[model samples]
Target: MEVKHERVKQCLEAMMDSGQLSVGERLPSEILMAKEFGVSRETFRAAVKMLEQEGRLLVKHGVGTFVIQPLPMIPSSLERLSSIGAMIRTAQLDQGESRIKFTKEGCSPEAASALGIKLGDPVVNMERVHTANGEPVAFSMNTIPQEIAGDAFDHDEFQGKLLQFFEKRLGRKIVTADSEICVPLHIDRHCQRLLLHPQTTVLMLKQVHYDEANRPVLFSRDYLRNDVFTFNIRRTT
Candidate 1:
């Protein structure tokens, strides 16, 4: 005989397959499900916790349990340079915003190396929180030449589009960007501030955008919330 927890899991799976439950849909009450499935209430609660830890369900503090929205699949095309704004929309989630910090400053060693500039080069640092459907999804830190970003007309123009901000704020068109990624088990200070305890592990994406002349037009480091921003990638090698 299967374990009690497995039985509950099986029942949930059946509901999901039948579409009675869906991504982001709530499950029945523990009491209701226990009675409905003829299981002890204790067993039922255990099952819900198991699934919740597995990232299949979300439990609210004072509310009920709900199905989790699946992570967005990473695109197979790793060659393309996509904006954080463009990527979330591609996944069909509403994009949200919170620009934490934006200022003009001198380039640090890391920034210089990434942007191909000497140390102390003037750079504009743009920091913001990227959101998905009103949920904080990632933290982005972008740096660009002060001259381009300093121009008022361009900065205002690029306000809505981070990539466009490059072109409009600095008069430089982005040709490509290099993005590196990883998943982490621990939460960052900022992540804790966002109030998200990722059921599954979290991932990191660090990138630097460069223009046609290979000048580091923008230096960026983005920490994506693993659950909400799922990515899909298809490849053959």
Candidate 2:
């Protein structure tokens, strides 16, 4: 009986990871879930109770069980450079997506300074929302030199790491980055809508990537959903 209950728990967890069961979505009734899993009602109840104790599900007395919003903590090493996609994959999250909201040719003073370009130099700007397991986790704005990012850059083709696109087009790898993290009081309307937690504080990451020759290649500003992602750093002497 214990073994059967454990299997039920594992199956449900996998469903959540694969986005088949989304956050805040209600689960089927105990009888249906038990039948679907080919388990007895007692075993199914044991599994559900375990998940509830783990804070993965919320059960109401008369209502059904629902998946709890997960707080996925992503550990970031200060000594290394990593992309949001890489972090999501490292956490073994299923179905990561970066949906491009828009792309334009523009130049911002801050982007110019970070990329070490003239004030009016053209830059390709892109805005995207990063999702893990079908839940919005971060919103990002990326800027790249226009010469490196040609006019053929397609927003729809962007899925994983943005740096991979640059590396493929420019034939130069990003060697390092200067990044800073801060807690911001508010985010834009787009991010608020996508994240579905408008009033929550956000963690902002400002980063500038450099190529092998130490030339700044990309500048990015990322707003992270604080409730969903917890960033941590490790220190050693």
Candidate 3:
């Protein structure tokens, strides 16, 4: 026999997936929902709590339960070299960064290859979580050659965009960037760190940025929530 709470949860999930319940729409009262699901109020409440914990629903103390909105979508063109910060702003959404970690470390093989530097060379690494409307939407790890970062490189003064920081702070203009898109095979580890649902779709972009002289100046790995980002590529005959 199916557990009462489990059955109720599945029905609620189906309703939301089918668009029967829209974001910010309140669910029926507990008594009504319970009766409709053919379960007791306790069982229905348990189901609601499960969805709330999974970030699918919001429960208010004095108010009612409402479907939680997913992260806002940001549309971008592959033709433009746009930063994550710029994307959020273009969408007219509030941008924020958290879990920032900046340090000098030995370059990894991947970073060394991307930046065209010898392995084990010193590099400046910056890791951060990007957020929109107080919701985490992406995680990024960026590496810069020690020669380019220089002694004047100060992480504290970094605003949001790395491209802007390079241009304004270091006088390094990025003329071009190459990006490769990939899907993560395992996103559970990232989900736990970003407070995302385990089933959230994620896309990863590995990039190498070059200056006007064609020298690679930066390498980065960006993991973004598919719910929040859309990239368009124009096709011409």
Clash totals, every prediction:
14, 0, 0
Compared with the true structure, what per-residue lDDT tens digits does model 2 show for residues 1-237?
A: 559999999999999989999999999989999999998999999999999977799999798899997555436655568888776665667646667764565688899999989887887788887788888777888898888777646546555567777687667699899989876654466446444655556778899999999988889988876666566775436
**Model 3 spans with C-alpha error above 4 angstroms:** 1-75, 187-192
Model 1 residue 58 lDDT score: 90
Model 1 agreement with the true structure over 31-107: per-residue lDDT tens digits: 89999889899999888888886667899977889987654455624566777787788778888876657677789
TM-score of each: 0.59, 0.61, 0.63
lDDT of 2: 0.79
Each candidate: RMSD: 17.5, 15.2, 19.5
Off by over 4 Å in 1: 1-76, 153-158, 183-187, 193-195, 198-200, 232-234
Q: Find the candidate with the highest lDDT and give its number.
A: 3
lDDT of model 2, residue 153: 66
Any idea what lDDT model 3 has?
0.84
lDDT score of residue 214 within candidate 3: 86
lDDT of 3 by residue, 56-160 (tens): 999997799999875433359777888888877776779886678889989999999999899999999988888899888888889999899997457377766
TM-score of 3: 0.63
Winner of 1 and 3 under lDDT: 3
Rank candidates, TM-score, best first: 3, 2, 1
